[model samples]
Target: MTIRIGWIGCGRHATWMLMPQLARSGFEIVAVCDRDEAAAHAAARQFGATEVYGDYAEMIASARIDAVGMAVGPEVHYRATLAAIARGLPVFMEKPPGATAAQAEELMRASEAAKVPVTVGFMKRYSTGNRMAKRILDGDAFGPVLGIHGSYMTAPTYFAGEVDYTGFYLHHCVHYMDLIPWFAGAEFADVQLRKSVPGPGRMLLHMNFACENGVIGNVIMGTVQSRGTPMEFVQVMGDQNRVEVENVINLAWHRNPPFKAEDPQATLDPGCDTLVWTPNFTAAANEDHKGYHALLLDVAAALEGRASPAPVIRDGWLAMRRLERMIALIEG
Candidate 1:
């Protein structure tokens, strides 16, 4: 069944990254909305939506749609989601589901009370290398996870004025709040932060945390790097084994390989040797290693009332709550 969707937020990300993936199959965007009328009409023309509106509420109320999808500001996400849930519609929205954890909690409770599903975009879980690492961790050969470390950095493009870190906290740092917990397979039980502000807009943070399952790790995030370079890496450690994902595309799995320094007949052992993987960019296939396509596939399934592994509002709430805690620590 083709799910008719009322799409909102026709920004660069929506037009370039998300809508193209959503348009692939099993969904028809019947209505488009953005506060910018020009962007709304432009997205409508590009994505084959018949109606365009500057007001999301008007679009949702009048459009003949089965679901809603949006990549908008946090406050709009909260309000628009509530409107959709009130009409018993399924939804998929970008991360930082609301401006605050309390608002996210409200949206979560409302979705539950109305018996609706509201999926959140935490596509880092679906990244190709990260997914591969998760598979290895779940395998019998890999022992219990001991620790995790991640570094995700970007430029201060999120900052517009007076060195405030609100945009950086919401738009950039929030991803790891969900990602680290997901990798640890447990909620965070304790958090401590160390911060450095080398300049007006540049801020660097090292957050140390312990999970409920006894996994401890540090995550490094900042608005102090160039976006042109690789800005992300994740490392998960186990007993004599480790998995590393570099820049979301390259992966290496290290096993307990025997030393071969004195032996001339050393061979690459499948059981103990390290395994690595990198994407074949020369291939003609349109692969989305950054994970929007894969994330939307699950989202579309959920929108059609089928079972999917898409992250939902509760995940958003948890991530937001953790983000708030981190921000409070930073402020203090």
Candidate 2:
């Protein structure tokens, strides 16, 4: 089923990274809205949306759309998502669903009360290597996950203008808030954080957490790296086995392999060996390494009333709750 969607952002992220993939995922851009009239009109022209508006509410009120999608600010995401829910429309929004955990909780209640699905853009879960690692973890060979470690970094661009870490926490750090718990298949039970600020706009943190399912993990996040290089890594440990994803594209799964260097007949064993995979960038195929396309496919499925694994508002609320806890730890 084609979901007629009114998209509420025309920024570079929406136009370049997101909207172009909507058609492939069975979503038709029926309307586009942005505060910038030119950007809205440009997105409409580029994505074949017939209607355009500078006001999100005006577009939601007038557009003949079946759903709503947006990549705007946290405050706007909260307000626009609420507006769309009031109209009984399903929604898709970029992460940090609201500026605060309380707002996210309110949105969660609103979604449940309205009986509408709200998908949040926690795309890291759908990255190719991470997805493969998840499949391996769920398989019979890999036992229950015991722990996870993650390192995600970015430059100080989020704090370029000022020393505010708000944007850094919301946009950069929030992805791991959703991802690590997801990998552990539990909610966080306790958290302890240590922070370091080397200079203005450059901060680092090490967050250690225990999950409700008895899984423990540590994540390192900061605005201290160069964006031109790879900025993410994850490792999930199981019993005598582990899986690692490097930069979201390369994967390695190490099973309980015996050392065979002494044997002349030694050979690679399928039963216990290190399995590795990397994408073929040279292939003449369209692929989204960042996972946006896969994420939207799930969103489209949910909008069609089909079963999907799309991250919902509940996930957003949980991530926000965890984020707030981490922030409190830093402040207190």
Candidate 3:
């Protein structure tokens, strides 16, 4: 009962992160499609896909694809996904699902009308750190969350040409925007964005979000740092403690002081240490940090009537709404 998957867009992300794992996961890569015919053929040959097409429409029409993986750019996502949904194929789309809110809404409507399943590629929501954070929040172990602060900083070299392809926030920082609310167990009420061009080929963006649970979040992203530096940090503060996820892999927790103190100097006493903290770090054994394998597994399980998709269509739509609001704020 192997699930046959048709892959649309055989670029670096697909070749490096996806195809290699499909074979090992018991899913068949039945067909491959890419704008570049050569790339499509190469992927199909390497992955043992039965068919290859330069046009996704051809692949969809001819291949026995039960599900589709869409790794195309933001601009193409809406049309590609809509086409698949119309054809009655379940789809797993890459992040920032579409370039605009209107496009995402269209996909949602189509998905509903077609009665097919759709999932967004906000992989962080499936990460080990995030899973643990969700558990703690759900169990109320962190008490009522107070707020969150997150940062995503990357070197300019990483954006050598991506700025011309996708907006900085959409290409890179959308992950933070999408995950903040999920980690805080809330949805954004409003967003504020501030941007600056400090130098050539460089951009800095600051986003402030007000969440539905009375939690305020601030996210800072910049493409002006040196290479090899830590690029991401997420901190959630609760009533009794706080947790920090560093570089998207490490997790650290600090418990709130058990007793109220009148002054900061009181904690400086040699025997008066108040905060209790524990730290743990584990490398994700899987290759894709977003748990690509787990996602596909979930999809298969859903297809088998075992489990439902996480970060389903509605989750993707909510993230897109926040992204649209943030983009408008930045542009205005």
- Whole-model lDDT values for every prediction: 0.92, 0.93, 0.75
List model 1 lDDT by residue over 1-332, tens digit each. Answer: 78889999999999998888887757888899998989999999999999888898998888999999999999999999999999888999998899999999999999988889999999999999988888889888888889999999999888776777888888888899999998899999999999999988999999999999999999999988999989999999999999999998999999899899988999999888999999999999999999998888899887776899899999999999999999999999
Model 3 clash pairs are none
| 2-92 per-residue lDDT for model 2 (tens digits) | 9999999899998999999999989999999999999999999999999999999998888999999999999999999999999999999
User: Least accurate stretch of 10 residues (summed lDDT) in model 3?
Assistant: 270-279
Of 1 and 3, the candidate ahead on lDDT is 1
Question: Distance from true position, residue 157, model 2, in Å?
Answer: 0.6
TM-score for candidate 1? 0.98
Ranking by lDDT: 2, 1, 3
Better of 2 and 3 by lDDT: 2
Error of 3 at 181 (Å): 1.2
Instruction: Give me candidate 3's TM-score against the actual structure.
Output: 0.85
When 2 and 3 are scored with TM-score, the better candidate is 2
TM-score of each: 0.98, 0.98, 0.85
Off by over 4 Å in 2: none
